[model samples]
Target: MSEFDVVGIGLNATDTLIIVPHFPSYAGKGPFTHEILSPGGQVASAMVTCAKLGLRTKYIGTVGDDERGRIQIESLQGSGINLDHVQQRKGCQNQSAYIIIDQSTGERTVFWQRPDCLRLDPSEIDESMIKSSRLLHIDGHDTPAMEKAARIAREHGIPVTVDVDTIYKGFERVLPYVDYLIASSEFPIQWTHQSDPLKALELIQEEYGIHCAAMTLGAHGTLARVAGKFHYSPAFVVNCVDTTGAGDVFHGGFCYGVLAGWEIQQVLDFSNAMAALNCTAIGARGGIADKEKALALMARADRRVMDEIQRRL
Candidate 1:
């Protein structure tokens, strides 16, 4: 068995969550109720989910020497994830997000910033980190660094899973190395210029020759093309309080399913269950459920909305 089940390389940020009664119109003022600092990011939050699910996880990324950086480090350390490869740059501001959450709807508006000082160069990724893990996960934030990691993982015969939301420059260089391309709904449409999501997925899968091409549809659940067949899994119903880390958690659950050798339908269903449960809390990672909790939700969850999506497929 591999020493680590999964290794993630990408971004991490400290978010300041401000709560207001309701989202006010532009130029309108409202009284804010509370504020809290939380640790979250695309790959970091996913790694946290993996750790919580009892996987041995490693995180490779960059942070600054600021207070937010310290907080982010502490959170990762507390989660028991290996962070030996996480670099801390001096005199730089750590990536930070000001997330304004509406108390009424539990939706958020974010303003985030990442300093150039924290960029991860390809030279910094060593072979040892890539070869030590059974699986590799990444986001498309730093294209060069991600490409380097993907190449190393491919060389070692390790599977690579990517969570891409936007079209990054030079992203094509990284796609060929990825075995699983799970992205947001907008990404496939934007990347292929195909209006139909299923067609977009097919085009991407055929072009990259990846094993699977999938996309997450916020409330509708998930859609994917696997083994030349289309599979759709609907999102579970839960009392949603905040949806900050739902997608990230979904990716983590999907990784778990892949590693466990579950069927494609099971994988999508399990991932949807995990993501839905995560929405019933405040922070991005606040609602990550344990195995029993997730299973319970899966067994007795409302998935009518998802059933409709499957009917369309």
Candidate 2:
């Protein structure tokens, strides 16, 4: 049996969350309530969410040997995730982000930086580390390393799930190994130059022959194409406090559904619920509701669909 249910190789970030009354206009200033330094990242937060949902998770990545790095390590340790393979680069500052969240609308503006010195080299990827997990999750940062990991996982017949928000240079090399790809709403359209999102998704899947191609529409939920079928799941209504880690949580939930062998529609719905619940709190991982809570919210929460997206589908 594998040592972990899910193994992730990707990015981790330490965030300083700034709470402001509202977002300011360009060259405009606004009084901020306060800021709290927190730990959050693409694949890192998803692994944390998976661990919280009772999945045996493992995270492999690199962080700077700084105070922020220490904070990230402690948080992962507390989250019950295995981090034996995480690299701590000397004389480097961890990846960090400053998120300015508007309290009135729960919207956020993020400014982030990741030093090149903290980059994970492809040579550091070990076959043993990846082979010990049932599922593999990765982000597009450290593109070469991610490609290496995903390829190794694919070679082993392991399903690779990618959480990408933007186009990365040479990302084409990574997509062939990816079985499940859930990306930001802008990624597909941007990747294919096919203004129509659905068509873009189709193009990507056709180009790579991936099993599933999907994108997350923040407040509009998620849409996926699997087995040549399009599945749309609407965003659930909630008292959204921060939309910071909503997408990461959705990835986590979708991972859980995959591990549980859920139907496509069920996976979409469960992921939507998880994302909605995460938005109810301040920090990135603040509002990750338990299974019972998510199910209850799924049962009672109202969903809003994007009319344009619906019409497109």
Clashes of each: 1, 0
Distance (Å) between predicted and true CA of 179, model 2? Answer: 0.6
User: What are the clashing pairs of model 1?
Assistant: 234-306
What is the per-residue lDDT of model 1 for residues 281-307, given as tens digits with 9 covering 90 to 100? 998898998777888998998874655
lDDT of 2: 0.93
Q: State each model's C-alpha RMSD to the native.
A: 1.2, 0.8
- Local distance difference test values of all predictions, in order: 0.92, 0.93
The local lDDT score (0 to 100) that residue 170 gets in candidate 1 is 99
lDDT of 2 at 283: 88
lDDT of 1 at 28: 95
